[model samples]
Target chain A: MTADQTAAWAEQAIAEAAHEPGSAHPSREEQVLLRIERARRRRPKVREERITLAHGAGGKATRTLIDAVFVDAFRNPALEPLGDGAVLDVNGGRLVFTTDSYVVSPLFFPGGDIGDLAVNGTVNDLAVCGARPLYLSAGFILEEGFPVADLRRITASMAAAAAHAGVTIVTGDTKVVQRGRGDGCYVTTSGVGVLEREITLGEPMVRPGDAVIVSGPIGEHGITIMIARGELDIEADLASDTAALHDIVATLLDAVPVRMLRDATRGGVATVLNEVAQAAQVSVVIEEPAIPVRPVVTGACELLGLDPLYVACEGRFVAVVDGDHADAAVAALRGHPLGEGAAVVGVVEADPAGLVLLKTAFGGTRIVDVLVGDPLPRIC
Target chain B: MLASQIRELCEPGRQYTFMEVCGGHTHTIYKHGLEDYLPEAVTLVHGPGCPVCVIPMGRVDDAIDLARRPGVIMTSFGDMMRVPGGQGSFLDAKAAGADIRMVYSPLDALKIARMNPDRTVVFMAIGFETTAPSTAMTVLRAAAEGLSNFFVFCNHVTIIPAIKAILDSPDQRLDGFIGPGHVSTVIGCRPYEFIAREYGKPLVCAGFEPLDILQSIHMLLRQLADGRADVENQYTRVVPWDGNRTALDVISRVMEVRPFFEWRGLGFISQSALRMREAYAAYDAEVLFDVPGVRVADPKACQCGEVLKGVLKPWECKVFGTACTPETPIGTCMVSSEGACAAYYNFGRFTRSRHKETSRT
Candidate 1:
C-alpha cells in the first residue's frame, strides 16, 4: 500500500475499532494496524472539567493530568519530560530547577512535619538531578484560623532542615487564606541548584545490565503519615524517612559509577523505576527479597493492602549504577547514616523494554506497574 | 508448601478451574503475582465479591443526591468515593462543593454526627459480613447514645446466596472455590458446607497472603486429585470453623437479611443483602432520606454480568479497554480495585501478550 493509503486505512480502522467489536479474522497488516492504533488511543487524557483527588494521587491519573494540562500549556525543552526537576543548560554549566507543594493532612507526622518535608523534598529533587545543593524559596499558605505557635514550630523545622542540607532559604512568601478555605497550612518550595561536578547521570544514562540500588527502607514516610491521620488506628514504632540525600548521593557518586538517581517522593521507588525503564527503553527486574522494608512498615502495608514500593519515601532514593560497581556503590551509600540500609534491589534488562517486573519472594514474576489511584485500606 | 511444590502437585493432563469468590483474594492474586504459581492445567476465575463493584449505579446517584442535600454530610469508604454514578462519583460531588467525606470506618461517621449535631451524617455502609458487624456496632452505639442524626445507607451484601446463584447459573463450570478469608472469619466454613455436600465442589477458605493463597491452591488440588470435596479452612489463624459468634450476634440484632437484593451485574439474588432492622429504622438513611430504591440497569456494552458469572473473561467484553477503563469506567467491574476487570487490566494485561497463558470462558 502507498503511504497515504496506509495512513488512511490505519485511521479508518482505529475509528471503527473504537465503536465496533474486534474482528475475528483480519489480515496481518490489519492486525498490526489495530494494535498500534489501540496503543495510541489508550494514552491518558487530561480533559476533565474539574480536579478530583485522583488528580493528586501521584499515579497514572496524576501523570495524565500534569501532561494534558500543565505540560501541554507550558511546552518547553526544559519542561517537556516532566521529570522531578528541569535540567537546564546555562552558559557552559547546568542548573536543576524544581518545585513541590506539600499539603499532607495532619501536617505534623512522626519524624517530620510539612516544614521538614518541604525543605528535604525540594533539596532531594535537585540533589537527585546531580546538582549541588544551593538555594530554596518557600511559600506558605496559612489558614485564617491556624495558630501562630504552630507556624513558628514549622518555620523552625524548615530552618533546621535547610541548615542540615546546607541550603539557604534565599527568599520566601506567605499568604493567608480565609477560614475553612484551606488545610491548616500548605508549603511550596522551589529549589535551584548548580551542577559543579563533571560526572553525568540521568534517566537516559540508564541501560541494560545497570544495577538498581535503594538508599534505605521504603514506606516509612507514607505509613507514618497514614497512621498520623488516624485512619487505620494501628500502632507501631514507625517514623518517616525524611532527610536530605545530597551527602549520600555525593558519596555514591565519588565511590562508584552511577547512571540515574531519583528520590522516591510522591509515588515511591516503583514509579522511579518505571520512569527510568521507559526513558532508557530497558526492563527493570526487581527482587522482592532484596528490597529493604521495615518490619513495622511491612505489617502496616499488609493490613492496608498497600504496596511498599508504591508508598512515599521522603529520604529514600533508587539509584541505577554500573553492574560492576553496584557493590561498591552500595557500600559507599551504606557508610552514610541516611543510607545505612542500602541494597542492590534489581537490574535493568533488554527484553520487555519500558516495563518493571518484580521477582516475588515466592519465585514467581509479576509486573510492577505504576500506582493507579491513592492506595486505600481494604477490609479483606 | 511452596508455590513451586503446589505447582508440582497439580494434575498435569486435565484442566481444573477454581473460582475465587472475594475481591480481596482477586486483589492478592493479582498484586502478588500468584497467578504465575498456578500450573498451566489450572485456571482461576474471579467472582463478584467486591462490594463497591456490586453497588448498583442508581444507589450511587442517590448517594450523590444525599451528599448534595443541605445540612447533610454523606460519608463513605475511600473505595466508594471514586465509583461512578449516573452523574458522577462521590469525589466529583465533593469537588462540586458537596459535603461528601471519606471515613475510614462507620464509627467515624457516628463521631462526625455527634460532633456536628446540626448536620445529618449518612454513612454509605458497604462490604460483606466482614464489614457489616462494624456498621451494626456503630449503629448500636449511635442508638445507645441517642444520636438521631447518625444514619446508615446499608448496602452490605451476604456472599453465600450470590455463590449459590453462580452455581445454579447455566454457565456454571467451576470445579472448586477459594472463599473470602475476611467473610469466612465472620460466617465461618459452615456457610460453605453446601457447596461440597450439594454441588460437589471443594471450597477452601483462603487468606489474603501470597503464601496463604499458594497453600489454599495446594489444598484444593489435593481435594481434586483424591476425589474428595469438602470445606477446608486454609486461614486457620483467623477463621475458626464456626466463625465469630459475637460478631454474628451483633449483625443479627442490628440488621436483617433482605428477601431480595439487586446485585449490579448478577441480577436479583434472594437473601443476598442486609438492611437495618425495624427497631433501628431511625438510624436508616434510606428511610430518613426517602431513598427511591430505584434499580439502574447495567450499561448495554458492559458484559460485567457474564464476567461475574465466569461465562466471559474481562478482555472478551467488547468495551474492556476501549470504552471501559479504570480512568473512565463504563462498568462497575472496572471502577473498584478488587473488581475482576480492574484486576485484569492492572495486573493481567501482560498475561494477554503471553501466548502460553490460558483463560477459559
Candidate 2:
C-alpha cells in the first residue's frame, strides 16, 4: 500500500479505538489539559487546584483532572489510536509483551520524562526478552489542574520516542484526578514484539562459562536523573541516560542464542547480577575496570557518601549467552548506535549460585549485593 | 613508609589486641577490608564508636515517639533508619507516612525547615565530632535564618570521654589503640594523651588506608613488646596537637557536657554525651518529641558490651552469624560493616564458620 493509504488506514483504526475508550484514555484527557485559555479563564479555581498523590489512583477524580488538562493537548496519530494493546508484527514466530509505569516527580526531566521513561522502559523490557519492540500502548494518569503546556510537551516527546523506536502507538487510555490528590502526571506503556527466528531466551538455559555483557556505562541513568531534579547540589553537568535499547538487543540477538537478558533498574548492576545468578543458579565474576562509569558520576558518588556499585540504573542491561556466541554478541551490540560502548563485563562460573563477586584492579574481590535502600530517593 | 614498618615488626604467634574508638575508623577498616590483612594473632576489637550502636534502645523508642507526633517532620542520616528501637525505628514510622526524612547532612535538615514553613522539623541529631559540626551548623544557621520550626534531638557523644570510659571498664583487655585520626583532627592529639598516660596503653592515631592500618598494628606490637605506653601520631598529615578551634568553640557554645548518658553496651558514662545548651531548647528534637517507653535491655545472651570493651571477640557472642548479621543484626556489632564482628564476617567469617559447620555435620 502507498504511504498515504497506510497513514489513512492507521488513522481510521485509531479513531475507532479511541471511540470505545473515548473518555478513559490519557491522550484525550491530556488534550483537554493543554487548553490554557480555559485554565486561565478559570484562574480563581486554578489557585485552589493543586495535585495530591491520589490523582495517580486511577478513578473518576483522575478522569476529570486529565480531561480538564492533559488530554486537551498532545493529540497525535499513535497516541490517539487508544488500542487495548499495540499489535506489533515481527519477522519470527514469537511474541514479546511488556509494560511499565512512570511516576517521576517531575513529569519532565533532562534527557527524558515520564513519557520517555514509559516508552523506553517498555521497549527495553521487550528488548531484554530478545524481542524487537513493534508497537506500544501509552496510558497517562494526569493530576487535575495540571498545566496544558506540560501535557503537550510530554506527549509530543512520547510520540517522537515511539517513532525513534520504530514502533507505532496503536492504542491507549487516560484518566484525571483532583490537584492535591496527585503528583503531576504518571505514564504506563506496554509493548509487544516477536522474537528473532529460532532464538530461544531465558535464564534457565544459561550455562556456566558463558559471558556477560553490559550496554554502555552504568549509573549514568541514576546520576543524570538525580542532577536534573536539582536534588543534591552535585556540581556536575549530568543528564539521565534513559533511552530505548531494542536496537542494540536485536543486533546482539541476531548474532547469538541469547540465554537471558535483564535491565538493571532500581538495584543497579549489583541487583541485576544477583538476580541473574540466583535465577540461573550460577556465580558471576566481574572485573571493576571493565565496568565503565562516567567520572562525574563517580566523583559525585564519592563526595556524597554513596557507592557507585549500589547506585540505580534505568537504561542499562546485563546479558548472559553461550561462551562461543560471546564474541559474536559483543560484535553485534558494538555495531549498533545504542550499544557503541557495550563491552564483555563478566563471565558465569560453576560455583556459588546467587553470588556476584567484583575483582578490583588491585587484585581484590568484593561482593556486589542488591541494594536494600533507595539509591537516590525520588529517582525515576 | 608505614607499611614497610608493619612488615618488619609483625611477627607471628603472639596474640595482640587493638581497639579503635571511632565509628569512622570502624567503617573505614571494614569498607577497605583492612582486617583481612592483619595477622591471625592480631585481634581488632570493636570499641563503642558507633553513635547509633550505643544510643540506648530507650532513646530510639523515644525518637520514634517524637517522629510520629503531628506536624513533626523528623529528619536523620541514612544510618539511623533501620536501627531497631524497643518496638520499631524511624524508618518504620517513615514507611507509615510519618514524614521521616533521610537527609545527607544536618544542613539538609536546616534546609527542610526553611522549606516546610508550616511544620516543626526535628533533626535527629546523633553522631560524634565527625558528624556534630554539621549539626551545630544547622542549629546556628536555623537561628540565624530565624526558622522557629527547626529543632534537634541531640544524642551527640564525645570520643575522649567514651575512650576514658572504656579504659576504666573492669574487662578492658586491649593492648593498645588504633587511635581515631578523624576525631583527633577535630579534637586534637592532646585529648588522647590521657589514653596513654592514665590507661598506660600505647595509642597511635592512624589514617584510614589499608597500609595505615597495618602499620598501626605494628606500632601497637612494638609498644607491647617494649612495655611502653605513649600516644603517637602516625597520621600527622591531618591531625594536629590541637584541633580545629573554631569548631570546638562553636560546639561548646551551642552545647555542653551531659552529666551522664545511656549507652547500649556501656551503660551511663558521666560527661560522655553532649546536650543542647538550654538556650537552644526550641531546636532540640528530644525535648520537642517527648515519647517515653520501657528501657528494654540488650538480649541476655549477646556479648555486645564485652565486645565493645575488647573483653570478648565478636565471634564469641553466640549470635554472630546464625541469628545476627548485617541482614538481621542481633547486636550493634553486627549491623555496621565496620563493627569488629561485621568486618570479620562480611569479608570472610563465613569461611571459618562453614568449615566448622561442615566438620560438625
Candidate 3:
C-alpha cells in the first residue's frame, strides 16, 4: 500500500477496534500509527485556566507550566535544555548556575531540617552537571511573628551544610510576609560551580545500551517528611537521606564515562527516568528488583497507595553510564559513603523510543510514565 | 512458579474468564504485570470496585458546592481531589480560593475542625467497606469529643451489592471471581458466599501481592475445573473467615444503608451505599448544608458503563486514548489512579505484543 493508503487503513482499523466489543487489541501497525498520532498531539502546553498546586509539583504539570510559561517567555539557547543547572561560557571558563526554593512544611523533620536541605539541594544540582560547587546565595521569606530563635537555628544549619559541601554563602536576601501569608519560613538558594572536567555529559550523550544507576535507596526523604506530618498514624524508624551528592558524583565521573546525571528530588527516580527517555529519544527498561528501596518506605507507600518509584528522594541522583563500564561505575560509587547503596537499575533501549518501562518481578513489563500531579504535597 | 502451575491448569481450547471485583486487584494486575503470566485462554475482567471512579458526577458537584461555601474547609482523600464534576474538581475549587484540603484520613478533618474553632470542616468520605469503618470511627470520635464544627459528607459504599449488580447484568460473561482483598479483610469471606451460591461462580479472596493474585486465580480455576463452586480465601494471613467484627459493629452504629445510591457507570443499586445515622444528623453535611442532590447523566461518547460491566474493554471506549486521557479526563474511569481505564492507558497499552512474544519464549 502507498504511504497515504497505509495511514488511512491504520485509522480505519483503529476506529473499528474501538467500536467492536471485546476487540480491544490493535494490530502492530495500527499501534504504531496511534502512537505517532498521540505524539503529534501531545506537544506540552499550559491548558489549565488557572494554576493549581499541580503546577508546583515536579511532575508533568510542573514541566508543562515551565515549558509553556517560563521557557517560552525566556527562550534562550542555554535555558532550552532545562537541566537542573545552566552551563554558561564565561570568558574561557565554563560555569554552571542553578537555583532552588524550599517550601517544605513543618520546617523540621527526622534526619535534616529545611536549612540543610536548602544548601544540599542546590549543591547537588550543580554537582550532577560535573561542576565543582563553589559559591551559593541564600534567600529567605519569613512570616510575621516568626521566632528569631528559630531563624537563627535555621541559618546556623545552612552555614554548617554549606561548609561541609565546601561552598561559601556569598550573598543573601530576607523578606517577611504577614503571619498568615507565609508558612513559618521559605528558603531559596542559588549556587554557582566551575566545570573542572573536560568530559561533556547530558541527555543527548546518552545512547542505547547505557546503564541507569541510582545513588542509593529511594523515597527516604519524602517518606520521612510524610511520617513526620503525623497524619496517617504510620510509625516507621526512618530518616531523610538528605546529604550532598557532589563528592559521590565526582567519584563516579572520575571512574567511568558518564552520559547524564539528575538528582531525584521532588518527583523521584521515575520522573528523572521519564525526562531522560524523552530527551534522549530512547527507551529505558528497568528491573523492579534492581531498584533499591527501603522496606519502611515501601510499607509507607503501600499504606498510602503511592508508588515508591514516584516518591521523592533529596539525596539520591540517577546516573546514565556506559554499558561496558557499568560495573566499574557502580564500584566507584559504592566506595563513597553517600553512594554505598548504589546499583545498576536499568538499561537504555533503542526501539520504542522515548518511554520508560519497568520489568516487574513477576516477569511482566509496564510503562512508568511521568507523574501527573503532586501525590505527596510539599514533600521536598 | 504459580505462573507455570496456572499455565498447566489451562485446558487446550477451553476459555476461562474471571472477574476481579476490586479496583485494588486491577491495580495489582497492571502494577505487577500479572497479565504476562496468564495463559492466552484465561482473561481477567475489571469490576466496579473503585469508590472514586463509581461516584456520580452530581455527587462531585455537591461536594464542590460545599467546598465553595464561605467559612468552610472541604477535606477529601487525595484521589478525589482531581475528579471533575459538572463545574470542576476539588483542585479547581482550591485554585479558585476555596479552602479544600486533602487529608490522609477522616480523623484529620476532625483535627482541622478542632484547630479552627470558628470554621466548619467537611470531610468528603469515600471508599468501600475497607475505608467505611475508619470514617465510622472518626464520626464516633467527633461525637465523643463534641466537635460541633466537624461534619462528614459520607459517600462510603458496600461491596456486596455492587458485586451482585455486576453478576445480574445481562452482559456479564465470567466463569469465576477474584474478590477484593482489602474489602474482604473487613467484610470477610462470608459476604462473598452469595456469588458462589446464587451465581454459581467460584470466588477466591485475593491479596495485593503479585503471587497472591496469581494464587487466587489458580484456586478459582481449580474450583471451576473440579465442577464445584465455593468461596475461598487466598489472603488468609490478613483476612479472617468472618471478617473484623468490631469494624462491622462500628459501621452499623454510626451509619446505615441508603435505599439507593448513584454509581457513575453502574447507576443506582438498592442498599448499596451508606449515610450518617439519624443519631448523628448534627454531624452530617448533607443534613446541615444546602446540597443540590441532582442526577447528571454520563456523557454520550464515554462508554464507562460498558467498561465497568466487563461488556467492553477500556480501549473499546470511544474516547479511551484520544479525546479522553489521564490529563484531560472526561469520565471518572480516567480520573482515579486505580480506575481500569487509567490503568490501561498508563501501563497496559503498547505491551500486548511484547507480552505475547515473551510468553512464547
Best by lDDT: 3
Indicate the worst ten consecutive residues by lDDT in candidate 1 chain B: B352-361
Candidate 1: deviation at residue B324, Å?
Answer: 2.5
Candidate 3 residue-pair clash tally: 0
Q: What's the chain B TM-score of candidate 2? A: 0.91
Report the candidate with higher DockQ, 1 versus 3: 3
Stronger candidate by TM-score (1 vs 3): 3
| TM-score for each model | 0.91, 0.81, 0.92
Which of 2 and 3 is ahead in TM-score?
Answer: 3
List the candidate 3 regions with Cα displacement exceeding 4 Å.
Answer: A1-33, A36-41, A376-380, B355-361
Q: Which candidate gets the maximum TM-score versus the true structure?
A: 3
Better of 1 and 2 by lDDT: 1
Q: fnat, candidate 1?
A: 0.24
Per-residue CA lDDT of candidate 2, range A1-380, in tens? Answer: 11111112223323432343222323332232222112212312111134433233232223335545655576554333222122244463567666778877666666778777888888888777777778888887888988889999889988988899899899999899888877888888888876655655566677799998887778876677666666566557777778888877777777887887878765577766766675677878787789878888888776665666666667778888888888888888878876777888889987655556665553335555544345322100
Candidate 2: segments with Cα more than 4 A from true spot: A1-92, A324-331, A376-380, B1-8, B225-227, B287-294, B301-303, B310-316, B320-361
lDDT for residue A307 in candidate 1, whole number 0-100: 83
Ranking the candidates on TM-score from highest down gives 3, 1, 2
Candidates in order, interface RMSD in Å: 12.3, 26.0, 12.5
Chain A TM per prediction: 0.90, 0.73, 0.90
Q: On a 0 to 100 scale, what is the lDDT of residue A92 in model 3? A: 94
